[model samples]
Each structure stands twice: as structure tokens, then as C-alpha cells.
Target: TFRVVGHFNTGKALVKATCGRTFNSESDAQTFLDACASAGHVVSSIETKPSTKKPAAPFTTSTLQQEASRKLSFSVSRTMGVAQRLYEAGRITYMRTDSTNLSDVALKAAEKEISKTFGAAYAFTRTYASKSKGAQEAHEAIRPTDLSASSIDASREEQRLYDLIYKRTLASQMADAKLDKTVAKISVSGRDEEFVARGEVITFEGFLKLYLEGTDDEDGQDETTKDMLPAMTEGQPMTRQTVVATQRFSKHPPRYTEASLVKRLEELGIGRPSTYASTIDVMQKRGYVVKEDRDGTPRDYRVLTLSGTAVQAETATENAGQERGKLFPTDIGLVVNDFLLEHFQNILDYNFTADVEGEFDVIARGQLDWRAMLKRFYAPFKETVDTTMEHAERASGERILGVHPESGAQILCRIGRYGPMAQIGGPDDEEKQYASLLPGQSIETLTLEEALDLFKLPRTLGEMEGKKVTAAIGRFGPYVRYDGKFVSLKADEGDDPYTVTLERAVELIKAKIEADAKALIKVFEEDETVRVLNGRYGPYIKAGKLNAKIPKEEKPDDLTWERVQELIEEAKNRPKRGRRKKS
Candidate 1:
């Protein structure tokens, strides 16, 4: 059944309003409703104030990387690569920078562009101070060398990034966006309960005409607050519609994305603008972190509403904790981190890295001796490293989960040679079971049930072609093994070896069969192992343990038995790389 709380009207279409706050309990909301009904609600206070939003500073290196990631879905390295290309092509200024200050010539160009394009009224010359102290990196922020070229002759990513840099450069010199913000407070006469409504009206477009916050446009505006409140005086009586209190829990601090990690590192002064992408890349390469996209889990929440002294409570579900290209630490990363924290406590501190950076800067300016700095850092660092090497136990990052219900064996998760995995027995136990952890599961968060699920793989899905089809996790990842061939599960499709249905497995098997059929060129009567096949780099001969490449001069289809044997022998006798021929 449904009930009408109240009707919402589209007012002047100039602002957006948030009506009520989430209540701690349903009774608290009910009590507020009783007060509203008994006291009667009225506009107790109202204020319309002039507000002006200043245009943001021009693109700095870190800002460029962040905005590109958020707006264009480009990774930090990809953004840097594209920016480097733009820089080499002489399309933009230096890609690497930590400053927000613009050059006089660039500032003049920006002002001229703003004046000619958006009128002289919109032009406002200004300089921005950088957040970083002693920031003289390349002197100017990242911007287009040619302001006239709104779009660059480059790839789609390059053009999009160019447009962002261009608009930001122009907007930095443009006028502030003017707005009139109206806020109203509704009071209950019987009690001290009140509700607040906020509305905003754009008095002047200013820089917003070209670029809004976080987004740039040559023409129309991005979506903004357009539901302006109706005219109401302080003494004017207001009708009670409804009071809603949603049950919301405090969220954990969000995990860092590649861009956010760079930002955080910058805040700590850990790395230079040029090093952020490389550092993050190294972390991923060394198995310290992984970037992944994940679907959020559904969480049930409650809502309590009061309309004219009637209170009702209901539960609802919402997808929560969805992650896209977010970086998460691996088990090994955590273990290594713990080891470093335990043994090299002072060195692992982020401030230590930042202070090292500061020392580098001081040395660069000739204010400090480089040799002294090295001696100071290396002596203590070397001593700690040697001490740890000799005394510290190897960090396997092992965590003991509960015992197995059936075998009474201990269940433990740790970093395995292949990756993170779960074990069914202790180190002293002779007989034990081991299963590779699924790509999505982690040692830190894996539960007993999830760990048990890992062992459930290699399960027979069903029979196909009179043979059993089973799904399992291999060193390469999850796969569906059918008959003698293996069809790997698709990561992008979110296929799980554990949950893959027989029908899906059969479909994958057929697809693999069809693909193999297309790849086969010709079979040889000379030998069963020797056959012609089409591969990624064109046609090649598969002979037993070795592959012989077909020369461009000889057509694969026209190759004779004698030529095939000669090619195979040539491939076999060819000296392997790094081996010297005997004199």
C-alpha cells in the first residue's frame, strides 16, 4: 500500500534544497512530528546572501592527473604518458610541474583569450599560490603552450586532456561566478524543533559560462541546483508536509585510488611531481597493490517518516562500497609493510620520506651538503638492513583462520609463491590441502566461509561430450577444464570458477573449440605433432616442443614437406640467445 506524504513543486528552478537530517531513532522522529503538529510550523528565519565562487587555479601536475582520472577515466601513468606526448609535440607547456603560478606571458594570453571570447568583463588577471612550500617546479602550472588551440591534433585522450587544460587556463583568468544563496529555517511553535531548506540562484554566469567546477564546456552548463524556493517571509506560515529520517551508518575511510594515492603522497611531500606515477606503477608491479573494479554489496537500511503525527518505519536495500579502479594492498604488501614497521620503524614513516625529499631540495639549492645527507641516511639505513637480514624471520604474512569442521585441521591464509592462498593444515602436518585464493578474495578480509569456498573449486560442473567438465583456479587464474583442454574464465565478465554454471561452461568450451578451429591452418601427414597454425604474429609451424616461424618469402599454404622439415631443423639448430658459438 502507498500513502501520500506531500507534493513537491518545481519553484523558480534556480537552486536545490536538502530538507531534513537523518534521525538517530524512529521515536526521535515521531517526537519531532508530534511537536510540529501541536506547535504548527512557520518560517522562523530566512536569509538571502550574495555568494561568489572563484574559479579554480590552473592545472598543476598532480591536479591534472587527478582530474584526468576522475573526469576522463585515465590512469595516472596514462595521463602522464599523454601529457608527455603533448609536451614533446610542443602542444602544451612542461607536463611535470608542482606550481600553480602562471607566467606573465601566459597570464596575458589567458586574459586576452577570456576578454575576446567571453567579453572584457569576464577577464580578471590573477596569480595563485601553490599548496607546496618552496614550489618552483618549472615555474608555471601545466597548461597549453598555445591557448588558441582549444583542441590538439592528437589521440582522443590527448584532445580531451588538452581541452581540460585549455579551459582551466582560461577560466583561471575569467571572472568569479556570482550567486544568491537563500536559506530558510522552519520552526515548530510547540517545541524547539526546526528544519532548514537551502536554495541558490545564479546571478551571473562569469567563469561558469565556460567551465563549471570539476568540468569544462565550450557551450552549455553542467547540471546544477535549479529548484529555487518560493518567496517566503520570516513570519509567513508554512504547512507541515513530512519529516524523513534515514538510517545511515558511518562509513570506513575510503580506499585510495591511483590518483588519490598520488594526492596523499603530495600532501605528505613524499615524492616530486615526476615521481608519483612511477612510484605507483612500481608498487603495482612489485605486488604491493592491485587496482580493481568491484560491485558493491547490498546493505539494508531503515527509514522513519512522520507525516501529520503518523509515523512509519520501513527497511530498504542499497548497493554500498562499489569500487572502480581502486588500489588495494596485497597480503605480501601488508607483510612487507609490517616487517619494515617492526625492523625499520623510523624509515617506514611517511614523514621520513618527506623529510628526505626536503633534504634533497635543500641539497639541490646548495644549502646542505649532499655527502652529509647521504651519510646521515645511508649509515642508519644500512645498519638496520643488515640487522634485519641477520636476525629477522622471513615474513610469510600467515594468518590462522578457524579449524576445518570436518578434518579438524587448521585453516590458514598467507602469501604463497603463486599469490595469496588458503591452507587446510599446519606446517607440522604431513597431509594437507591447499587452494589458491580467488582474485577478489584477500587474506585480510577473507572469512572462514570464503576460504572454504576457495577449496570448493575444481568441482565438476557437469558432463560435456561424455567427459566431466570441472572449474578450478590455476597459476594463470580461473579456468574451466573440459576433456583435455582448458578454457580460462573471463575476468572482465566476472566469471567465477566456483559459481560458473554447467551451461556457461559448455558455452565457453564451444567458443574455445570454434576459436581453435579458426586458428588451425593445415595438418601434416609427416608427423602428428607437426602442423601449420595461425598465431598472433601470423602463420607458424608447431613441431613437438618447438615452434618454427614461416618465412615471408614462403607461403604457409604452399610449403612442401621437404621445406617444412628444413625449417623445423633450422629452428632446432639455431643458436639460442646469449649462447656463444665455439671457436
Candidate 2:
């Protein structure tokens, strides 16, 4: 429900109700509307107050990562990596720290810098208290090593990170920003319902002048709070232009981004500053979660086009396909999460995790025995693991989707060794044919109709030049087969092998043949032939045995022979990975 202020029918300003008040039923609503029409309303009261926003504390590791993710679009790992480089170069203090307390030397430097840059009025000398329960007071928060060394020669990414740190450190020593808030209570002439409107304006910039804290939302300020309200006194009459009653439902919690997840982990005391980036990295590397592009729009409604007219209808389910970077749990991740909850409840418990973290802190402070703590935790955990290993059922991702209508066989969706797949026969049947689910289909939500649709695989697209041509889904993706020659289908174009026509299949096969014939990109002046070809992991250029990945910023066709040679050399000189020996 919303209320707006505007001109009324009469030249004299007056408050009026527009939409019918909500009730238990339509009849009740009508009765209320009739009552409101007979009655009247007036401005009851108004209040204006002053509010102030205090400056945020100096950067902790978690807060720093959160800010970088929100403002610079930097991943937590990337931010830490650049910060580590800066720390190593003596440009910043230790990056891995939870304490918000600043050293006397650092604070004095910040005071000098703030006073010199923004004048004495903007300087704030009060020290901030550490909010973290486990913060180490011995270590200071992240700050510049030398405030005067603002300009430094660094990489583009390092420069941005340095700038952020410098501004944030200075802003931490600034005054609070002042705001004026106004709220009005308007009574309808004949209605019992009262409408409330609120607005606020920033009266003093203060710390906001140097830096405004970033939020998870792209817009740092709330729309309602940012709006400026006109001056009004108590009992001043207000004209209601319109009253809108919108049927709004509660929204589902948003998916976690890197910043939000770090914040949550910190709140729960699940991990320390140093482990935050590694924890997220391990999740992605193990395929428990995948970073993918998603649509930013939370689709709460579906637009239907009928008879050339578009109508928007509210929906519970969101539509797929929005472009933004976010992390999503895979089927395996869900399975693992459920399995851990069932078998290792104590280990996976939030309180248990936090308690263990507290125990580690105790050990760090030399107040507890580390070995005793480990022994107490390990005994039950080992026993549970041993018992569950023998009894727990394997989550093979198998689900019976009911019997097939015509085949009389049961349709089953399961996660095979490769990935999620569906079959059309019983477990003992040797002749069961399996097919992978369509790109976006999920086993959890697979219906009988959708499962049966998978049986239409290895589709024959008719003969091409007297040779039989077929299209089907392979391990990689959709492909067309003609006379034993397999041609991969490109979705960037309007091609889907699942629904490709005979003519399209023939054309694709021809294109594949042409492409294969010219795999050699160029014969360089150094007698090196650089060939661009598809590899197990996307597309790359091959010079001898060294393969160079095509950078996202550079197109394959735009590469020159010299650039190819340089890329090949770069790939050849790349460092090899191996386990590090403990010192």
C-alpha cells in the first residue's frame, strides 16, 4: 500500500482517501469503503527529527573484502591477493587482521593527514571499539604504512585497492554525518485508517564526503530515506493525490554473494580472516558451489502476451536467465549438505562450529590445552564417521519418476559418475538407455513428462549427401553426426541439435569440415604454425604441444602471428604446480 501527496479537487488543501481500505473479505472491504465515504479525515499530527550516521570502524579483513566486492567488483580472493602484494611491498600493514583498533603511530598519522586534507573540523580523534568477540588486540587493523606514500607505482588492480584502503583509513577518523528526518501521520476524512509518510535529507556530509560505506545492494542509500520531505508543521493539512493498494507478497531470501557470505561467516564465527578466502575458494574448486552468470532481476511476476496485448501476472517462481555473477549450489552440494546434516549433525551444527572456533581462540590465548580440545572433538566425530560409513546410503541421485506410459518401464533420474542423467529402464535391465538432462533441467523437479522426453535422443536428421546424419547430446554438449564425422553445435547461433532440422545438420557438418581443414591459424615467419582449435577446456591456440588460452578480451580472428607466438611462449614459460614441502 502507498500514499502520495498532490493537488485535490478543491483549491483549498485537504486530505482525502483514494483506495478502499483492506479487509478480511471483499464484502468487508466494500462495507469499510461505504463507512469511509460517509465519514471524514484531517491531518492528525506531524514530527520532524534529527538523525546522525556515525563513521564505520577501520577496516577488518572481512569488512575490507566485503567493501571491495561491493564497490570494486573484486572477488574476495582477488582482493586479498592484491592486499598481500601491497603489504609485502611495505605500502600497507598486515592485511589478515580482525582487530579494528589502530596503532598510536597509525592514528597520529591519520589525524595529521585528515587535518591537513579536510581541515580540523572534519577530524575525529575518538578511537573505535572492536566489535568482534575474538579480535586480537595485539594486532592493529589494516591501514597504510605511510600516509604520505599515497602515490605509488603499482599494477592497475593494486592501484585501485590501495586507493580504497587510503580513503577508508582516512574516512575512519572523520565526523558523523547529520540527517533531518520528517514523518507525517495523515487521517482520512471519513476513514479510520491512517497513512504514514517518511522522508530524510542529509544535513552534513562529514565522513560521507570522503567515503560512503558500500552495501550489498548496488544503491548504497534507501530510496525512502533519500527522498527529501517538504517542511510541515503539526496539524498542517495535506492533500492526498492518490492511494494505491498493491497486493505484495513476501520475497524469498536472496542468494549469497561473496561479500554477504563472508559477512555471514564472520557473524557466525565459522572461520577467521585468513581462512575466509580459502574457504570460498575450496567450495568452488570442489564443485560444491559454482560461480555463474545470473539475471539480477528477481522475477516476481510473469508477463503474458495474448492477442498482441501484454499482461503482467504475479508468480511465485522466478523466471530463468538474468545476467549477474553469483554463486549457486549444485546437486552434489545439496546432497552433501543433506548427508552431513543427517549423519554428522554435531559437526555441521552452527553452534558446534562456533564453539570449536571459540576453543581455538582459547588455545591461542594459552588458556586451554589444544590437544585436549582436539581429543574431545575427535572421539565422537570419529565414532560417528565410522558408524555412518557402514550404514548411510549412497546418494546416487536416483529418483523414480513413475512408470512410462507406453514403454511400461520405470523412468529414473540419477547422478552417474559423469553427472546427472536419466534412464528409461529398471536397475537390473541390461538394455537400459540413459540420456543426460537438458542444460537447465534438474532431477529434483523432473516430471514424468520431462523424463520421457529424454528418450527422443540420438535423433536422426535424415541423409546428408547419401550419408546418414544424426544429432544427439554428448559428454560435452549437443552435436551432429554425419558419416562418422561429429560436428559440435554452437548455441551462440540459433542451433540446438535436439531440434536441428536435416538441412541445418548438413550445413553444420559442412561448416565443421571446413573448420577442421583450416585449424592452422597462421604459418609464422619463424616456421611456427599456430593452430586455433577447441580443447578439453574451451578454445585455445596450439604451437607444437604448448596451448595458449584465448583471452576473453581478445577475439580469435583478431590475433596476429606475432601475438600467437608471444602467447605460446607465455604458456610454455608458465610455472608448474606441485605440493610445497613444509619447512
Candidate 3:
């Protein structure tokens, strides 16, 4: 069995010993700690405090591309090129944003465009506003910098992005996207499954013309969104297409990529507009991550990172009796959570976290004293920590490893209720204790021999080969009653058979409709006026069954244009009095 990599917990002192390197400067460590303190302040402390300032700047090209790619799967290059064309053609304002606020001139242009394009009813009294407190209001919002200019013919890529951004921007400047949402609750095998559909009716396509997925900025709204369902009234029953029953195992914390990392940074309030890209670059350069090429028909590469904070937390716990500044969790994060909830349930109260946040908010607003707030929080938290340490049983630091022998590959085992057990691995011998992996596993782990063998088989016979019989499983013929009224026409049989080519089909249908018979066939044809010919009844007009007939002596040519015109005029000038009574 091949061993890939194994993990063990160790402290900073043990880490230095493992590397045979001495700690030279304690002050350097202090400097690093000071930087982390500053980061913490910016993240948890400052961001928690409310700001009354203007919003941040509008989205820059990179940020816009990143967001679009993250949310919509738009490529960065495609996003930039399309945004460029929109700006040049006067469809959208400048694509670049380092400033969050719109200028007076830009605001006026947007307002005028809104009024002119949508009308005053749809236009706003005030330009749309955003609530971002630190927004740079110098640059204009992502509006069409020039409203008077007309749109131009765009390049292929430009056309797509231009249409999307333009629609988003316009929607942003307009009203909320109105949608009627419906959810159908279905019962399957005694389980409640909900199928949802959303009928999104653009009541007003607002700034959505410029951007779609984001906090509703450029407008003063605090509404968040949920994936909506199609419109339907309550009590309306729906037929389910299929019941898909699937089993899912629990999952570990997901590894973050560049896009996900940026999302996390936003959520953490650790980084902002200009710093996101650089922070990703920094993490990559710091040896915390490694980028690998993805294997496929066309190969692409992406970065993968190991959490340094997680590693540090693992190491800190190894130094049993030493003061580790602040307590951290790593391999034991979930275990600690389970233990706290199972035993010390009251200490980690659900409402405790929210209350602590409330106290911080009060402090920031000068409604509560900061020192008192910290004192109240620390007393309980410190007591809980001490109790947990005194009462909780110790965890044995175990080095975990598992391997499958058949393919000589590493197995990703988990620390289960039993010891480290194989969760995934290569195929193994059934008799041995090795993990028995199934066939047709992932393509990435497939050997070259296996791949070549797949292509070696004849997937289909050559054109010259004899007829190959195959099972006819599903319904194969046109819908017909089984009462034997319809004739069975196979490849070898024929009855009322006609070639179904496009030309022949059209001609047949046309002939059927134009026949001197039923009117049903004429329903789809262009001519709405119907024609009729009679013998004994002569030529009778059937308009609403109020019939008239031409005399037998009168020829069709006798109805001249002059007489028709005179009759039309006479009808128009007729008196509105009651019809003359038949005498």
C-alpha cells in the first residue's frame, strides 16, 4: 500500500524542533501578533459598528468580471469586452469603478434617460441610492455616462454581455423585479418533497440591466432574495414528472477556491474592493495553496489551498500545559462542538452569541460602556472554558492512515466512531481487510491501460455488416387503439403508406385543405373567405345563413366593378329609419 500524506498535531516549539531551527526574535512574533490584532479589529470590531458615511465605489472591471463569473459563469475577458462595447456605444455608464457614489451629472443623465425611455411614471423622484456607508461617491454609478448616444452593432461576445449588463443596469434604475412564486408539495414514499417554480415578471427591469446578483445597491432596499417558483394559486394540484430518491452522506468543510475565497472575504468583512485580488495572490504565494492542472478534453488549472489557521490551531493544542493565547480548534473542531452540546449544553447557549453581539452594538453606539460589555461577556465565556477543561475527558492524539492494496493507491479515510477507516480507495481483495472499491470509479484514477481498452472495443458495427437485431423496448409506432382497427405497417409491409418527406407532406396537406369538400382541412390556410358552388339552388351566398342567389340567366361576369361600387355607396347612404314592412 502507498501512503500519500499523514497529519499529526504539534506546537510551535515542537515545530522548530522538527525543523532544527531556533526561535531568534520574540519581538518579531509580537509584531506578527500585533498585525493579526489589527486584522481582527477591522473584521469583527469596526465592521460591526454602523457607519453613517456614503457608500463604497461602484464595481471596477475586475470586480465586475469576478462577480459575473462567480454568479453567472461569464468569463473575465468576455465580461470586460462586453462592458467596453456597452460603454462606447452609450448603452451603459463607465464599466470601471473605484468609487461607489454617483455624480450629479451622471445622476441627471440617468434620470433623464429613465424619463425619456420609460416615461415619467416609471422614473424616480430621486436618483436610486445605496446604503454602503464607505462608498466613494465621486465616480458616477454604473449608468450610461452618455444618454443621448445610440446603441451600436456589437461583436459576438460583446452582444451577449452588453445585453445582460444593459438589462441589469436598467433594472437597477427602475422598479423591483416582480415575481409570483409557487411551491408544490408532493408526497413520495411517505416523504414530503417540495417542487418550486417562479414566474418572474419584470414589473420594471431596474439596474438589473447592468448587474444581477448582488445586494440591492443603487437602490435603498434591504430585501434579500430566495430562489422563487412559478406562479400558481393555493390548492392547485400539480403532476410530478418523476420522484428522484437519492442518498447523501454528511460532508466535511469545503475547500475554498479563488472565487469562493472572495465570497468568504466579503462575508467575513476582512477585505474590500481593491484588496480582494491581491489577497488571493498573497495566499497562493505564501505556500498555503498549490495550483494544479485539471485533466479533461481541454485542460484548465485552478488553485487549491490548505488552511494555515487550521494547522496553527492543531499545533497549539499539542503543547498540553502551555498557555496558547486563545483557544482554537482543528481536527477536533466538530468533536468539541458535539461534546459541548451533549454535556455542557447550557454554557454554549443559542441566544448567548446574539446577546454578545447586541452588547457590542450598544457599545459602538455609545449606549453601553465598552469595558462593562467585555467584562460581562468574558466572565461567562472564561468560566465555561475552565469548566470544559476540568470536566471533559482528554482526547488521545492519534496519527491516522489507511491504504488499499489492489491498485497500490492511498485511501482517504476518516476518523470514524471506530479508528481511522477508509471512506474512499482503489479496488481491494474481498478476503483481505482492505477497502473494497467498486468498478467504474472516477476517470481521474483510471489507468492508461483501462482507458485504451475502452476505445479498443467495437462500439458499433461497420455499415457493411449484417443487420443487427436490437430490442424494441418502448412504444415504437404512432398512437393507435389496440382494437386492431389500424393497420400495422412495418419496414416490409405497406397499407395507405406515404413517404413523409418535407416536400411531399406539405403538398399532401395543402391538397387536402384545397379539396372541394369539408372546411375542417382549410382551417390552417391563409384564405379566410370560403367559396361555394351550387346547381339547383344556383349560386347561394352563406354569410351567417342569410342566403341570396343570382338568377339562372345572370353570368358571373355580369357583376361589374361599377355596379359593386354603386351598391356599396347606396348601402352607406341608406336612411337609419325602420326597415320597410313587406306589403
The lDDT values for all models are 0.81, 0.75, 0.39
What are the per-residue Cα lDDT tens digits for candidate 2 across 1-583? 2222222222353333233234444334334434433444445777779888888888999999999998899999999999999999999999998988888888888888888888888888668887765666567888889987666799999999998988888889888888888776667675567665567788887888888777776424653245565555666655434332223334456678888999999888788889999999999988788877865445453222111122222334554345466788877787788888888887888888788888887899899999999999899889998999899899776789999888688789987776778888997777887988877677788888888877787898899778889889877788898877888888999888668899888888888888776654444565545677665575688776677888978877677878887888888888987999999
lDDT of 1 by residue, 284-312 (tens): 99989889988999999776666666777
Q: Quick one: how many clashes does candidate 2 have?
A: 11
From the highest lDDT down, the ranking of the candidates is 1, 2, 3
Name the 10 consecutive residues with the lowest summed lDDT in model 3.
Answer: 11-20
Q: Residue 445 error for model 1, in Å?
A: 3.2
Q: lDDT score, residue 307, model 1?
A: 61
Candidate 1: list runs displaced more than 4 Å. 1-22, 215-227, 460-470, 482-484, 489-514, 522-531, 541-549, 558-583
Best by lDDT: 1
Between 2 and 3, whose TM-score is larger?
2
Q: For candidate 3, give the lDDT of residue 57.
A: 29
Model 2 scores a C-alpha lDDT of: 0.75
lDDT of residue 23 for candidate 3? 21
Tell me the lDDT of model 3 at 50: 18
Q: Candidate 2, residue 392: CA error in Å?
A: 2.8
